[model samples]
Target: MAAFIIRRLLQSVLVLGFMSLLVFVGVYAIGNPVDILISPQADQADMARAIAALGLDQPLWQQYLIFLKQALSGDLGRSFAYSIPAIQLILERIPATLELALTATGIAVLLGIPLGLWAGLAPDSWPGKLIMTGSILGFSLPTFWVGLMLIMLFAVELGWLPSGGRGPTTELFGIPVSFLSWEGIRHLILPAVNLALFKLALIIRLARAGTREALLQDYVKFARAKGLSEARVVCVHVAKNIMIPIVTVIGLEFGSVIAFAVVTESIFAWPGMGKLLIDSINVLDRPVIVAYLMVIVSLFILINLAVDIIYSLLDPRVRIGEAKT
Candidate 1:
C-alpha cells in the first residue's frame, strides 16, 4: 500500500509538472497583459519600465523557468489585477465553491441512488420508466437553461428564495458557510439544485447499470436462495457490490462539479471561484487564470488519488492487481 501510494504520488507530480508548462505557455500566449495595464497614451519609456517591472521584458523560456522555480516553493506570484497573492485570492473563494459542490453532490446521492435502484429492479414498471425518462431529460437540458427556469419558478414566481448570491454567512469551524443558517440554505437551494441536475442524472444511470449487473451475479442468487427478504438481498448484497463503481463516480464527479460550476455560478451570481475566474478572464489576468487552472488540476489529481485508494479498498481484486503490477 505504501509503495502504491508513493507510485501514485510520483505520477501526480509528473502530471502537475506537465500541466504547469501547458498552462503557463497557454496563458502567456494570450495577448500581453501590458496592453491592458498601460494606457495607449503612455510613451516608450513608460511601456519599457512597465514591461521590465513585470519581467515581461525577459525571454519566454527564462520567464517560465523563473515561474517554475517560484511555483515549486509555493509562490504563484502576485495577481497583476488584484495585487494579492494568487493562491490567497483563490482560497478566499474556496468555501463558497466547496459548499455548493458538496451540497449538489449530497442531493445527487440522496435522491439518485434510490431512484436508480428502483428503476434497475423493475425496468418494466411505470415508476421505473418515469425515472428513466427523467434521467434522459436531465441529461438533455443545459445547466444554464435549467438554472434560469428554476429561478423563474422558485425565485421570480413563488418568491420563496433569493435569486442569487451566497447570502449572509456565519463562520462554522473557521469556514464561512451558508448552509449553517436557514436563510443561507434557502439562498443556496437554486444554485445547488442547478449544479446537481446533470450529476444527478449521471449517478442515476451509473447506479442503475451497476445494480442490474450485480443482481445477476451468483452471490445475489445465493442470497435469494437463502430466503433473504427482497429488500435485504438488494440493499445488502446488491448495493454493497454495486457501490464500488458508484463511489468511484461520486469521487471523480465531485472534482468535475468544482471545475464546471462556472455556468451555474454565473447564472446565480454566486461568489465562488467560478465567478472569480470569469472576472479575471475579462481583464486577461494571467496570474489568477493560471493559478486557478493549477488549483483545479491539483484538485483533480487529489480526487483521482482518493478514488484509486477507495476503489482498491472496496474491491480486493483491485489491490491484488496493483500488487502484481
Candidate 2:
C-alpha cells in the first residue's frame, strides 16, 4: 500500500509539471493581459514601464523558469486584478464551492442509487421505465437552462426561495456553510439541484448497469440457495459488488463538478470558485487563471489517486494485479 501510494504521488508530480507548462504557455498565448490593463492614453514609455514591472519584457523561457521556481516555493504569484496571492483568493472561495459540490454529489448518490437499484431489478417494469425516462431528461437538459427555469419557478413564481446568492450562512468549524441555516438552505436548493442533475442521471445509469451485472453472478444465486433474506442478498452481496464501478464514476465526476461549475455559478450568482474564475477570465487575470488551472489539475490527479487506492481496498484482485506488476 505504501509503495502504491508513493508511485501514485510521483505520477501526480509528473502530471502537474506537464500541466503547469501547458497552462503557463497557453495563458500567455490567449492574449497579453497588460494590453487590457494599460490605459489607451499611455505612450511607449508607459507601456515599457508596465511591461518591465510585470516581467513581460523578459524572454518566455526565462519567465517560465521564474514561474516554476515560485510555484515550487508555494507562491503562485499575485493576482493582477486583486493584488493578492492568487492561491489565497482561490482558497477564500473554496468553502462555497466545496459546500455546493458535496451537497450536489450527496443528493445525486442518495436519490440515484435506490432508483437505479429498483430499475435494475426489474428493467422491464413500468416503474423501471419511468426512472430511465426521467434520467434521460436529467442527462439531456442543459445546466444553465435548468438553473434559469428553477429560478423562474421557485424564486420568481412560487416565491419560496431566493433567486441567487449564498444566503445567510453560519460558521461551522470556521467555514461558512449553508446547511447549518434554514435561510442558507433555501438559497442552496436550486443551484445544488441544478448542479446535481447530470451527475444524478449518470449515477442512475451506472448503478443500474452494475446492479444488473451483479445480480447475475454466482454468489447472488448461492446466497439465495443458502436461504439468506432477499434484502441481505441484494444489499450485502449484490450492492457491495456493484459499488466498485459506481465509486470510480462518482470519484471522477466529483472533480469535474467542481472544475466545470462556471455556468451554474454564473446563472445563480453563487459566489464560488466558478464565479471567481469567470470574472478572472473576462479581464485576463493570468495569476488567478494559472492558479485555478493548477489547483484544478492537482485536484483531478489526487481524486483519481484516491479512487485507485479505494479500488485496491475494495477488490483483492486490484492489489494482486498491482503486486504482480
TM-score, one value per model: 0.96, 0.97
lDDT of 2 at 100: 94
Candidate 1: list runs displaced more than 4 Å. 320-325
Tens-digit lDDT string for candidate 2 (1-325)? 7777788799889999999999999998989988888899999999999889888999889998999999999999889889999999999998899899999999999999989998999999999999999999999998989999999999999999999999988999898899898899998999999999999999999889988998898989999999999999888888888788988999999999999888888999999999999999999999899999999998899889888888777877777246463
| Clashes per model (N, Cα, C within 3 A) | 0, 0
Residue pairs with backbone atoms closer than 3 Å in model 2 (clashes): none
Candidate 1: tens digits of C-alpha lDDT, residues 1-325: 7877788889989999999999999998888999898889999999999989888899989998998999999988788888999999999999999999999999999999999999999989999999999999899999999999999999999999999998899899899999989999998999999999998999899889988999889999999999999999989888888889888899989999999899999999999999999999888888889899999999998998889888888888887346463
Whole-model Cα lDDT of every candidate shown, in order: 0.92, 0.92
RMSD to the true structure for each prediction, in A, is: 1.7, 1.6
lDDT: worst 10-residue window of model 2: 316-325
Candidate 2 residue 173 C-alpha distance from true site, Å: 2.2
